[model samples]
Target: MKHTLYKHIQEGKTTGKKSFAVLVDPDKVNEATTEQLVSLALDAKVDYFFVGGSLVISHNLDECIRQIKVSCSVPVVIFPGSHSQISRYADAILYLSLISGRNPELLIGQHVISAPTIKKSGLEVMPTGYMVIDGGAPTTVSYISNTAPLPADKADIAMCTAMAGEMLGMKLIFMDAGSGAKNPVSIAMIEKVSSHIEVPLIVGGGITNPEKAYLNCRSGADIVVVGNAIEKDASLIRELSDAIHSVPVRV
Candidate 1:
């Protein structure tokens, strides 16, 4: 693992720079669609491309990754919904743990099954702690992981969970509202969790507009992830880039 992507994230932390990542689920985006997104990402200065989904039914993950790598300069990080989502074509993998839930599979069982393969794939494994917050609806991630999200207003629960993840040595912390959520993670939750953790904070799901994306960054998120929003409106990429990068990332 060269860690180019991880290093880029670290540099952002050091310089107080915020980043934007566009999620391209292979189940959702094809090769042609991926090329188009990558082209737009290059122009928008999207810092990373997150490639994966909760239920990856498509067999074209590798092909999509290959096309994006050929078309873009941004790092492609594997946002795996499961161990089966692995691909060496990516620059890195967010090795996630569903710490907000007690599901043994997401926490370590799946990792146990996939670790050997992931080790062999050579993708930069970023140990990420994944927390799902109530997004005002039932999300695919919540359903798939068999875990309930933390209450939207329970900042204390979210913060303590993130603190536990950091103490356990996670490299990154992700606060997700689940894809196609009715709302993004609340600004209060982002502030509470990020203030306590030293790791880079990533917030995603249902951030449909630049305003929400911008607010996430301003609230202390180091990275703002937009997927369904981009899939709905590719033009939002540039605006979201401006929104997130507008505020300096502060830990």
Candidate 2:
């Protein structure tokens, strides 16, 4: 079945709830560990699974996605870092444009390279406006993408960047703090962006606890993505899911 992420978000809104997603970076975990993680995530009642990495130095991207798709019942989406990460096995891809960075490579260069392959794969393409916020530390994404992050204190700049993306016809806005961040994207920043953008807002990175996830949702984030946190303690998944779901839906 073809999965529509936008439809899922609308359904959540209609049902008056928020959703939880878990990110699985294949490059970071071994096969045995990945299998266990998939099982744990499935058991946790996570709404979706996102698979990808900033640097997939491993040539096993396709194999890793295949395994996860076969092992888990939840929808598996590709949160790709580069064009090379595309595969037919996944349900969809977050076709991201790094709007926050001045680097033209991430903004349009990579998309041009990946477009043909993506069209051929017949995967659902979710046009996402990606904005990286300062995480209080240097992160893999910031280093590899060669783009400086927007200062965490600068909510106004972030707002304008996101609005520009929406005007450019992007479907969703993802505000990320980069994995293993010293601090997650602030609630103030999330609130500012969420209030401005008409598209669904997805907040991620450094969200290590249920409280943090809950706070993001309460601040108006339409979806919350958790990665490194669950990798360390798989058992926290259920708690985080419940916490995000506990927030009152925005009217």
Candidate 3:
């Protein structure tokens, strides 16, 4: 029932303080890289570490969270890809409902199977509306979820979906372009959605550089997440984090 992570995000939205989150996929990072990431995150003062991925084929999820916990004070949140991705080690979980797709399994089916376990795990649950925006490529998330992403250019659809999620009482709205995306979500879509929703807005995928991260925050994303890009070049962490945190909070 703790609202620590959610409260921080809500406050950030209210204050117009943009947050930068580093997405760490257990399948992609080893202990060494995770340690390296921890060091960078501490230096950059990252807001959160999102653990999990679209298709995690490894058994390192728990250990990944442990490693992060022992290394830094930054919050660790599970951006779970499936029911099996839950971990007691993390501080919080984004209990995502895939609102952008018609797949019943993603919207509610997965939640049912995971709810009991999540409750038992004692992780702070963040009811999130997860919308996957087309990232100009066929990414793993679309294939694994068995859902098509919202078209990149369709701002209206994205806006309405976010509005519906907010009305449904979801605590957060996450719009992702999917990892390894060729293009991030459009500014127009982000602006449209953020303007409509009262909850904090999260935008991720295809945000490879500080400039892109800065733009996303300026466009209205309260939190910007990056993963694949950091996986390839760990040095970008500071730049990306700095860029996101530097945006002047809009009044």
Tens digits of per-residue lDDT for model 1 on 1-251? 56777877878866779999999888888767777888888998989989999998979889999898887667889999998999999899999999999999999999999999999999999999999999999988998999999999999999999999999989899999988999899999999998888889999988999999988988888999999988989989999999888895456
Candidate with top lDDT is 3
| Residue 169 displacement in candidate 3 (angstroms) | 1.0
Residue 237, candidate 3: Cα error in Å is: 0.7
How much lDDT does each candidate structure score? 0.90, 0.88, 0.94
How displaced is residue 61 in candidate 2, in Å? 1.8
- Please identify model 1 stretches exceeding 4 Å from their true place: 249-251
Instruction: Give TM-scores for every candidate, taking all chains together and pairing residue i with residue i.
Output: 0.97, 0.94, 0.98
Clashing pairs in 1: none
Per-residue CA lDDT of model 2 for 53-78, tens digit only, reads 89888877788888888887788789
In model 2, where is the ten-residue run with the lowest total lDDT?
A: 1-10
Worst 10 residues of 3 by lDDT: 242-251
